[model samples]
Target: MRLHVDERHERVLALVRARGSLRVADLAEELGVSAVTLRRDVEALATQGRLRRVHGSVVWPGAAAGAAPDTAAAPAEVRDAEGVVAGMVVPTLDHPFGEIVEGARDALEARGGRLVLGLSGHAEGDAEQAGRLVAAGADGLLLTCDRAPGPDSGGWVPGTGVPAVLVERAAPPGSPGADLDHVRCDAAHGAATAVRHLASLGHHSVALVLREAADADHLRAGYAAAVEALELTPAPGSPYLAPARLPEAERIERTAEHLRALAEEHGVRAVLLHGDEFAVVLVPRLRALGVLVPEDLAIVVHGDQVASLADPPLTAIAPPERAVGEAAVALLLERIAEDRRGDRGPRRHVDLLPSLRVRASCGAVLRAAGRA
Candidate 1:
């Protein structure tokens, strides 16, 4: 018989307390469960402060000072040498990027490496931040930018003398950083998937509402492609409903009005809103304007963060943020290894697809049919 969730969690805590710490893989095996399932149980326990997660292992929360050996520590052969250090630069630690950074840190620790983080507000500041991290003994670098680097950005050069990989940001062809390795989510595909989902729900017309940001262009491109391919009608006016210059309250109000008009005048019953923050606030305003969610309108948010917490949980197009981070570190580590061996390889550009998390806000009737 399969163990109940609470029973499994209790078992996991008991085992960790008895042994001090255990590799997630080993724990999963002992419990006769898949690694993924075990990880979920561990996450739940960790959230409740019953256990702590480090690298790829779990430990008792109070046994940090004298717990079992850290399985992620460097082996005896390299114990005398300096441990590998990776520097990561990001614009902010909010939402998607926070999860991305966490993923990178976990992957690094699993390989007996450490992560040093830098926060930069613009592309111009990334180089300076990278320099500081390098000076602090970072062996490799992971960089993220607010926008795609152009030829004139002077952001990252291939000759930085440090192994580096771009995360969630790519360079245009012929740019200085064009040859750099990069791992990013396929934003276009994500947007297209959202459009397709709405179409499958019998919505003939869909409107898009987006904030101005680096990923906005990609999202627009994907949305346009899907609309054209499906021969679906688009809601009138521009997709950029509110300008960034407006105050937060005013911006939300303006966006709400625009969406209301789309539904009332254009007969658009479905909308794809980029970023969860705006969507969560827009729902209430739409309600105040006599527009009932999933009744007068259905919404699909692009970002998954906080989407599930809304009154009517929002269906979301979730980019594989953590996966992107892990992949970036893996690529950077490989590049670092190749450099030490005096070997050079062709540049690699990796694009990971996003998945839709179906929920209530999209008015999905197929929830019980495994569409959720």
Candidate 2:
């Protein structure tokens, strides 16, 4: 009946003592345990008077006694303790997808989990970073896109010895994803909703300009389903086009040219963007084409800050950005618990729904002239 610091527990405690008023989070990352589990250890040690607990740090006797939590963490320390989950984000820098990236990170932390970020530039790098995270002993991951380059196969991001959940897009075909534990803004549903609103406004010929990403494929399928459900056909040669990667300016220029051709060949009168970046970059190009917003042609896009500031504003599909983050944290916690129990369960994935935020950009195109 003797109680001793398990060597593992002792190492954790020693690190805390040496680090002075360290966050329970730091120890968890180093020891490869969930923050929640480590927090328990901190509490147990505090009760035994091995340390005193303050807001987020544990203080030894006479250890300054009043340092702020942020100050207590050294510049070198990463990850948080007292969390059962570790969330990793690829491409830790700024970009159009910053909201989703932030959402995922925030989600992990809010659920009392640790969020670790890895910056990967391209598809190859993203997949590599994911593998590194799993090898580094992360219990689970919340990623934006597959990041895994090449042909989709069985050995994908999720199968890499960790429970990975995609925050936004759907899982690869034939890939068994756990239920909709995914907290996302339903992109397909949102697109359908936007199309419906435009149809209600008496427009029939609409075209979508989307980025050429793996996730955009989902948006395209959803758009096609909606088009079919509404019984709409492309106006002659107005077939949808999916272009490969292009620079921001080039994407806009190319889309504008495509829109012009579609407008002439198929009488396309409305444009829906696949991604928010498209909305920002293409708005000017549309104006240059003399397709006055809501006058000659209407435009809709996934929501962005540019929507609010752009001339005539943009109608958009708005993702539950904040909620996605919150959900990421929740899912990570569950995965962490499962891991702690030594359960190597099947992979998990969540598919969230997005909402459409109607604005002036996707307003009614003049029906009188086009219909006649």
Candidate 3:
């Protein structure tokens, strides 16, 4: 019977002894087991007096005063299959990417799992957040990164050995990076499609106005490629790439003025703004400058966040935010199950395409591009 018992229980005891008092979360992650399983093991061990539980911490037998306290036992899996505790860290809980967090939470809940959310405000604190999740005994990690490390960059391998799935991030196709599961929208295709739509509108002097971001490189490359493919000429200094989001209202006004000059001075007719929020703010500024949208300068935004809320209703390239988040959670849960069973198999990476939602902003006859 002893030999037939789960080998993981023995490993848990050994680890606790070695650490002189290891947190339950740490032991769970190290064993690649669920928190619920750890609770059962800890309860059994406590009965045997092999270890002492110290107010959510674990202590070695005969441990001195002031022994290290550990985390409380996490809930056990509800059913036969292993339950996953996924940790997700994104830039913010506001517009744009916030919907991704909601979608991920919904998906995890549907699968009888939990999510631990963190905010890093871009990639600034992503590594730190990852550490916290792992230390908390997350079974799987769903990360939204500014830039996914490529194959040569060691490929987003978490030091905690937790399986990672990237949401709304890009990685080189077919590279060793593909070994990690991912879900993202096709940035290039989204930009190219928007440009093509504008070109079809007979706008020859097209320009791009984008605030600098991690996805800017892909947008730039796609815009250049689309211009060449369509035999269209970009207005001089066509892609006005800013170093950051125009923070101050004064900065936005300055940008609007510069854009107005570019339009009249250089015959620029159509402009693609980086996102809808900017378009919402800049359109009024353009009106203040006597620029009539769609009549004088047609506008398109790269993201559809709150686009409909704008005065004119914006045409936007809608990132697959919610879809990507849901898919990431699904993939991460799959990886968690496989990993628990010691099945280190091939990886999965998924890239979703963005769709253009057209409205008054782009002067579309119908709601979308394909409308008859």
RMSD over all Cα atoms, model 1: 6.0
lDDT (C-alpha) at residue 362 in model 3? 72
lDDT of 1 by residue, 1-372 (tens): 899998998899899988777878789999999999999998999899999887777878876432333433533322211267999988889877898998788767755678999988755378888888888988889998775556855355454678899899888877777777899999999999999999999898889988877888889999999999999987787476568899989999988888888889888899999988788998999999988888889899999888999988999999989879978877887788777778878889999999999999998854455664
List residue ranges in candidate 2 displaced over 4 A: 1-81, 122-128, 134-137, 146-161, 175-184, 236-239, 242-251, 264-266, 342-349, 364-372
Please report the candidate that would top TM-score against the real structure. 1
Backbone collision count in every prediction?
A: 0, 17, 3
Question: How much lDDT does each candidate structure score?
Answer: 0.83, 0.62, 0.73
Q: Model 3 residue 77 lDDT?
A: 26
Q: Which parts of model 3 are misplaced by more than 4 Å?
A: 1-82, 121-124, 146-156, 171-179, 243-247, 366-372
The TM-scores of all predictions, comma-separated, are 0.81, 0.65, 0.70
TM-score of model 1 (CA atoms): 0.81
lDDT leader: 1
lDDT of 3 by residue, 1-372 (tens): 233345766787788777667656567777777778787788888889887764344667876433443312311221212256898878778765787887777556544567898777755477778778888988878877654455643244557588888787755666544556778878888889889999887877678877766677678787888989999977778688654645658667877887889788888878888878878988998999988786678888898878889978888899888778777876776677677777766777687889988777776643344575
